[model samples]
Target: METVSVAIASIGRETLLDTLRSLAAVTRPAGVDLKVLVADDSKSGAATKLVTAHPIKSLDVTCLAVASGNISTARNALLNAADGGWLIFVDDDEWVEPDWLVKLFDCQKEFNADVVIGPVKPVYPDNTPDWLRRANPLYTDWGHRGKRLYTGRGGNTLVRVDFVRALKLRFDEAYGRTGGEDTIFFAQAAERGARIFATDDAIAREHVPQERLSMNFILSRAVRAGQSYGQMRLARHPDPLWHMVFALGALAKCGVAGSLALSFRLFDKARSFRMRQKLSLNMGKLRAVFGRPLAELYKKPD
Candidate 1:
């Protein structure tokens, strides 16, 4: 490994301090060069102040202040600024175990994978609802150790910097707020035959705020995710006829799932939520097949 940069983009000051503190605990083997790059996308530039007041230990850190908002732009800035051979991206609202980077590195060495993926579990703050905890909307896939994966979240992944740069793989700015930039970017890499693998051992934790406890919020996110999935698929085909066929299949799936979800609602809250979620996702896909935008979940809340 020439160098590995842990890239993080933070908008709010709400979670940046804790995230940096957690990174302070990261343990790396001797002679393995590692650095941290944090892009502060907050209007107030709070991340810089926090870093100055309390420096992260043993690691050379670069604090960059980019335009406020636009996560994809922040990530792109991080990629452009990084001089490392590998880039490991983690969300600013999350924390990693001391061995998180080590596990990702080991997985890459073993599999020769171009993209090494990991897991992220939700850490609900106090007063989180019981149902929301059970729903676990924030959790990404929990793949078996060494399992190969083509799709993953950017919150926890180690990407080959050179490969990405060479292929010009980047998070789409159009999705700076919609939150599927990672999906689209990774999907593009996979389409180009880039090897993406999963490491169940490499884990991160996303701190779920109390506001996200709303069932409405969770369902809305799922719907947007489904729409993004469909949009990506349609982008590949880009034919009106093909979109119509895909829309039919998606609509049928949504119909069946919706019926079952309605039935499940009377008896099982968990099953109903799950089914409703599935239905919502397919519905988003259904909407996308026809070329309409999904509900803009990332619109600046006014």
Candidate 2:
């Protein structure tokens, strides 16, 4: 029987309970020994307490008290604890479908892929702003189904344990607090000849909270994404000339985007917002290229 471990790294969010419940309700695949692992990053051990109080009888669940504000630390804890041939990662704010595991396995088998990535759909609240709702910037594009990808996110992914062990892949501690650890990890895996493929059937739904609905949050996230991409590019190719070339390209893009945003501000609000987001992203890339410190977006208050 193939052993499979589903892992989650959390900061004690109330939505984690719902995520656990969804996992308990998934249809287990035949001949698969499945287990669920949760790494509690909350210093207070809130997730550990919650799991102890309300156990899922249908699933074999284990919670580890990591107590680290760093997401990479929590994920590394999961990686160390997992005793499975395959590992699946899902976010605390997201829930999977009944056939999520089966679909991921099917894709892996079909493509002979080392890493299989699934799509994440955002569930917006009714009270969300109309413009934000219409724009839907939270939705991720993983390209078409069965297409090969150079990198993938950790939110909804199935990884072959043998491939990971072979490559000695681990999330970078430098990006632990600032996000993009997954981007760097997957990019490294792909660079080392890991085949990454995407599947359309295995879907995870992420719940968007009220705190993330603001324009400020959206633009900030865009900047963070750009920073991650810039950092990853530099890490892959450490030539000083490459850095200068990328920085110049980002500067030109930023100028063009800023001008377009100013020109469309009065007439096309949505287009203007998108242009502004693009400008912020390029500005973040510039910051990364110049070795500026990144904002710790995931750090918990002391």
Quantify all predictions' global Cα lDDT against the true fold.
0.81, 0.88
Clashing pairs counted in every model: 0, 0
Off by over 4 Å in 2: none
Compared with the true structure, what per-residue lDDT tens digits does model 1 show for residues 124-194?
88776676567666676747777876666678888888888999878888888878788889989999888
69-132 in candidate 2: lDDT tens per residue? 8889888899888898999999999999988888899999999999999999999998876776
Angstrom error of the Cα, residue 260, model 2: value is 3.6
Model 2 TM-score is 0.94
Candidate 2 achieves a global lDDT of 0.88
> How large an RMSD does model 2 have?
1.7
